[model samples]
Target chain A: MTEIPTTRRLDGHSALITGAGVGMGRSHALALAEAGAAIVVQDIVAETAEETAGLVRERGAKAHVMVCDISDVAAVNAGVEAARADLGPIDILVNNAGISGGMAKFDDIDEAYFDRVVAIHLKGTFFAAKAVLPDMRAKGWGRIVNVSSIDGMVGCPSSAHYCAAKAGVLGLAKAWAKEFAPWGITVNAVAPGYIDTPMMDGLLDDAGKAAHVAARIPLGRMGVAADLTAAIAFLVSEEAGFITGQTISPNGGEVIVGF
Target chain B: MTENSTNQPANSRFDGQVALITGSGKGMGRSHAETLAARGARIVVQDVDRAAAEETADSLRAAGGDPILAIADVSDVGAFAEAIRAVEAAAGRIDILVNNAGIAGGSPAMEEIDEANYDRMFDVHVKGAFFATKAVLPGMKARGGGKIVNIASVAAMGAVGSRAHYCAAKGAVLAMTKSWALEFAPWKINVNCVSPGWVMTPMVHAVTTAEWRKTHIDAEIPLGRYAEPWEVSALVAFLCSAEADFITGQTVSPNGGQVIVGI
Candidate 1:
């Protein structure tokens, strides 16, 4: 068999990853750096963003830190502008920042909590993508990977707001994929199942809930941050240019939603 | 858009492994075989035509692959079972199965569809994949785990012209992929589907003119071009690799933004 040689896939690309302070966002930031892309690590917390930037620098890749709450459109625009100014035009954007919005019964759900989740999860994704398009358009090359959840694809009890927001993110990805394809940008979403992250700890509530979720996964284990990153890495790669407007579910067979 | 080959390392993701790809004589199936075999897999090229299967095997051999040939109509349960046995006997075990054998039947309107054509479509796509998994399940379970990628179409997810039978069959494959994934999770078998949009292949070329494709199909696809078979194969290879261990029961589409447009 003819073996192709390995080379850095993102040697000249600069990526902006939101929620890069911890969990999947951090992992994505590190992985993109390792793949040779300079990173802009953005998080609501200044310390966490700096922490992630430190890790990115350790990998021999340049890192710039931006602190902002993505729910605020002005903050998102400013953060993205600062990232591009510091790191050059963003070639890749990973909208990984999100909140779980703690579970609430559908009928008793607080209007304020629902709006908060939507603003951050759905609206935030839209803002991030919108912010990066100009540079991507000028260069005619870009990749956008939105971090959604299995809850978005399947109904999860007591997480209607989270589900709706995540689902909306998918819609945004598809819409933007078409709108941006003419400019050589590809937009996709990743729906991760129960990954072993701080977020999962907050979502499951107990060991029994975690175990129950794990049992349902065909892979027989909770996914790790690396699992999610692997899919993200593939989506953001140059080889994946033909793949756009799709949602890849790395859920370990927990839920299968096609199309 | 410029088409530059990505310089990805040839990791032995499928080394010391045996893969069975149905209808691998040409098109996307051939692409899948080449991708997997290039990554160090011994391929079992299955096709309904012996000559076609041998042709694919010959190409694999020329590319430094130790390929075996299995000629059988997958729609026939007995033939498919016999073909699986032949593969096991020749290669020891099956570590991967790509159900890429499918026919694009005439796109008759729903009411105009004949029972014969509809049944043939379902028999070949849905039932063939179902029984192929059943045949390989025992060996894969005994060997610990395996990967199964069913080659579905974007039609499964949404409407596609008048090909109701084709869409229905592909849709069934998608649903069955999930069911098998859930049932075989304990056994460690990963089942997924790869749904492609408009791909530039002999089948497609025979049906549509280049000008027609450019004006009607390519214009609609967000990527502004039809997908090469290798692009589809690349995604399937990833799904079959170790890196994709946590991804199962998912329909990963490499459709150049077609699905997003919504039928």
Candidate 2:
């Protein structure tokens, strides 16, 4: 009934995806590469990042592996520099690297635990955007997609840390969008809802997942990587020039939000 | 629309889908038609202006799409509903419905606006989008799945000054889009809204001068320019595509950093 267009929307561009080892980040890398973008796959896990890079290369697009914890500002800057040297300047930045802590209510949550979650999700996003802005500014064109979540929009019970970090990224995208639009750069967030990714597997078992979907998600299923990736592809394409500072929630009707 | 457009199909995303776009007589609606037709949707051009609608049909035919015409103003609920059913009968089924039928509310301050003008604004944008979706839902549900994109404006998101009716109408459309997404999800219908920022449409040209363009676009708008119709159309077409199957209850604004906060 439908066919995904084979048009390469990102030809001659280089994209940097954080947390590209597995799940949503890996999916975004593959989809962008499929759209003709040369990918810089960055993740703390060197092996998985390389695995994603290999996948990108197999698609006949260039790929470079950069291994670094995105939370480390110095390391992220170095990785961006090395990635630029190996491939090209980052024309697109998907601030996708994130960490979700196991459920700990506010009383049980330790300072270290909260800091780590915020460090990885919010701090990591901020510094990564900082690292890639100069190149995009000079070029006068770029795309930045921050991967937020349903928890970000609507608060998640017992997952306040994750929610705060995720929501922080949304604010970051808005501020960056306003700041960078003059340079022809767009910054936006894609807040996904209950996606069937590795992250969910870590949080919920099969039964929990099914019950949640049946109770909450109207689509009657968990979202897939393709759903998020397709949105990222649209946000990064040339046709999306007029769009910035927006959060496109591909949640299968889970959360109907409006201005 | 050009081949460089995002909706320019390399393999036809909507190869067999039938898309019914209201207000296809001119502006962004026509571009939406072109974008979808390029991807192989059988278009049903619905517009009150017969002359302009015919022009759009001719272009669609030239672009290799066999389009149907439903010459009815969307605000005419009974007549437009009948026209929609005619489209369903003619085209076998309705797969996509773009509630793009709208008129520009003139720049009259809230007090200066008359009751008739206010009613006209809501009648076209709000009532039109609402009933049109109501008309199309059964066919879409029967067909297993469907995509509905309501065309909103950036004016709905902020105080754009004057034309409170237009803003209110678009704001209602945004709210209605949310309700529809929730209400229609059981039927596998994905309802969404596209709030474009300062597109260079007739609605804009009717109000602005060179000075308005130079100052307003450059000063207030971040991208320092307005959007081309295809730019907004490509986004609408994306929402209608299978790739966007999981996206519902969402409002995508391609407004070049104008009025970013939509919370």
Candidate 3:
């Protein structure tokens, strides 16, 4: 039998995870809740976020579900405040909601497609971080784990827009790492490869594309949500105070770039 | 030994794979070899020190596994060539490569870091891992698939007091992994890297005094303890397995709640 720690890693701390309806955002919410944090599950899909909140409640944790499109600034601010009013200060923020849209070669990318990707991922992350920054600064302790992608670090064939936005997340993390370090607000990101999730399923449904993408990774397999969860869990934990402005990749040995 | 055996599953994910681990004379490399061997992979124990490499090979033999010994300085060009040729002769195929051989030079400040230290660090980590991958890639392409895992450090993610060149070199390795992954993807070759935090290796223990370590490494990681080599080895083995097929162009961070860089 394995030993269990007496204290929950995030006990008494409240966490706000954007895109908490599905995919990585959902995983982060549940993982943080398991670690003893009250959760604010915010998503564009009201019912989906509520479903996630229901799961959290079943786990005997306090959860407030909010329906708000993270891409909208005013909505994000109000949602954050509602969460703070209900659960106390938001000590941890997980910016995991993102959209890959349709994959296309760089030359094929249209302005609308590119703009949407940026607005949801890049802009969404900025506004969410803005909303939580003051509260975290007041408390003098905060953790931000952004969800990026391996494509962000190294460019991809049809994922130029997605890659650029994710790369933006990294830049944002670095700048904030410096900006928030003084306030003890550590920010980092987790870049996953082709993780097996609803998002991946949709992308990989085309057999030709799936085959082409799968052959590129070194691990000879697709990533599971568990793989990413383990990495994020370590990052947002209190033990990760000194680990700011860093990008941790949990891809199966497919891209061997420097840390 | 004909076939090594341990508690890992048979028809194991690593079955039929030949894993070449650098610096297997001891520490993280040895742990990687032992674990991979247990998973039914043929092992290539490599190190700069001859006796140490052979000793590790002997240990694998005693453990009921087959391991070939290759003693050569990874920084030396001719030595790396010979090592690859030797593995081809022993194992008949190169299915996996783990670039774990490296040196952790002194704790001199960035300005005080001398040229000799910088060159040596890059030579072993950058040049060594580079050529080794270059030599093995052709064989992997011929075989239609393979895996490469480079051992990077959290230091590469940012400035960590000293070891500037080491950080830069590892960063290059990380970048190179991405390029190589894209280049070799058509051939079904996957290349990835592992960037660990302060793990309790002999080199680390030797370079860092107890007092210095207490204040630096121990105090930095959130877990408040150094990682065991086996912990990193588990991650390496998993990456080499079939389960990680879609994981290319990525770095796996196994630091104990430390090094929160972007994923």
- Please tell me which predicted candidate would have the highest DockQ against the true structure: 2
Per-residue error (Å), model 2, residue A22: 0.5
lDDT of 1 at A233: 85
CA-lDDT, candidates in order: 0.84, 0.87, 0.77
In the order shown, the candidates' Cα RMSDs to the true structure are 3.2, 2.7, 7.8
Off by over 4 Å in 1: A1-8, A105-112, A203-206, B1-12, B109-116, B261-263
In the order shown, the candidates' DockQ scores are 0.47, 0.53, 0.14
Clashing pairs in 2: A242-B254, A242-B256
lDDT of 1 by residue, A1-259 (tens): 2232322278889999989999889999998898899999989999989999999999999999989898888988988888888889998999999988577789877888888889899888888888988999999999999998888877688879999888888888888888889888999999888888897687676786667765686677888898888888888986577899888888887776654
Model 3: per-residue lDDT, tens digit, B157-242? 75676767877888888888788777777677777787888778777787778989778754665444576666677667766766
DockQ agreement of candidate 1 with the native complex: 0.47
Which candidate leads in TM-score? 2
lDDT (Cα, 0-100) at B222 in candidate 3: 47
**Model 1, position A252: C-alpha lDDT score:** 83
Query: Is candidate 1 or 2 superior in TM-score?
Result: 2
Regions of model 3 farther than 4 Å from truth:
A1-8, A104-114, A157-160, A201-206, A253-259, B1-103, B107-263
Best first by DockQ, ranked:
2, 1, 3
